[model samples]
Target: MSEGKVANSNRAEQREQLSVAATATDGVQVLNPAGEIDHHTGDALRHALDVALTAHPRVVVDLGGVTFMDSSGINVLIAAHHALTQAGGWLRLAAPTDTVMRTLQIVGVDAVIDCHDTLRQALAD
Candidate 1:
């Protein structure tokens, strides 16, 4: 778990806010985000996605560690999805908590992007 942890040096002092790896799962880039994602921390997620996409367009954002999310996070995902799709790749969301899942559902992002109940399912698909 300690492996492939992308430092949060560019975003915040809390390094645990995001963990990223180009090939964390089946050669697919994975981003593990923790804590609440809001206006203040949304840029961190965005930056993480930017870095992830540079290595590979396909990415799976593991949201199991995320507790809360707002419009800012949704916008970040939408942008990342657009970028990946344009490159002939895709973005997948995995293991979102109930609250976060509800946020995605309410925003209709669940319909636009692929959402999975588990990280395994997301990567397997």
Candidate 2:
């Protein structure tokens, strides 16, 4: 492959890996994030959580589309979780990919936060 073509392909992949959304259902907010969560996008994720929390007290973060997660991403989540808890609200994680889950486990965060297998279960609880 040509060098230019390779660079374009890499850029496309990175673009495709960046996405985040917040949806509300039954008074619960669901943050559906897609892509690799790293230092570059952790701020965006944190902002999304802040916006969601403003409207909905209960939040369920759908991590099914998250392909990768780093320490910065985990810090954003932990901060959100703490903020929600202080406000008498709840923040839960759902459908984390193997890589993301492993990262959480390695960091010992799984024991501190509530994680569910699906968004439905997370919201229902």
Highest lDDT scorer: 2
After aligning candidate 1 to the native by TM-score, how far in Å is the CA of 7 from where it should be?
A: 26
* Model 2: ten consecutive residues of lowest lDDT: 11-20
The lDDT for every candidate, in the order shown, is 0.86, 0.89
lDDT of 2 by residue, 66-92 (tens): 988899999999999999998888899
Q: What lDDT does model 1 reach?
A: 0.86
TM-score of 2: 0.90
Model 1 weakest lDDT span, ten residues long? 1-10
| Residue 113 accuracy (lDDT) in model 1 | 96
What's the lDDT for residue 98 in model 1?
Answer: 99
Candidate 1 on 13-114: residue-level lDDT in tens?
563354433356666898988887888788888998998888887899999989888999999999999999998889999999999999999989999999
Clashes (N, CA, C under 3 Å) per candidate: 0, 0
lDDT of 2 at 67: 89
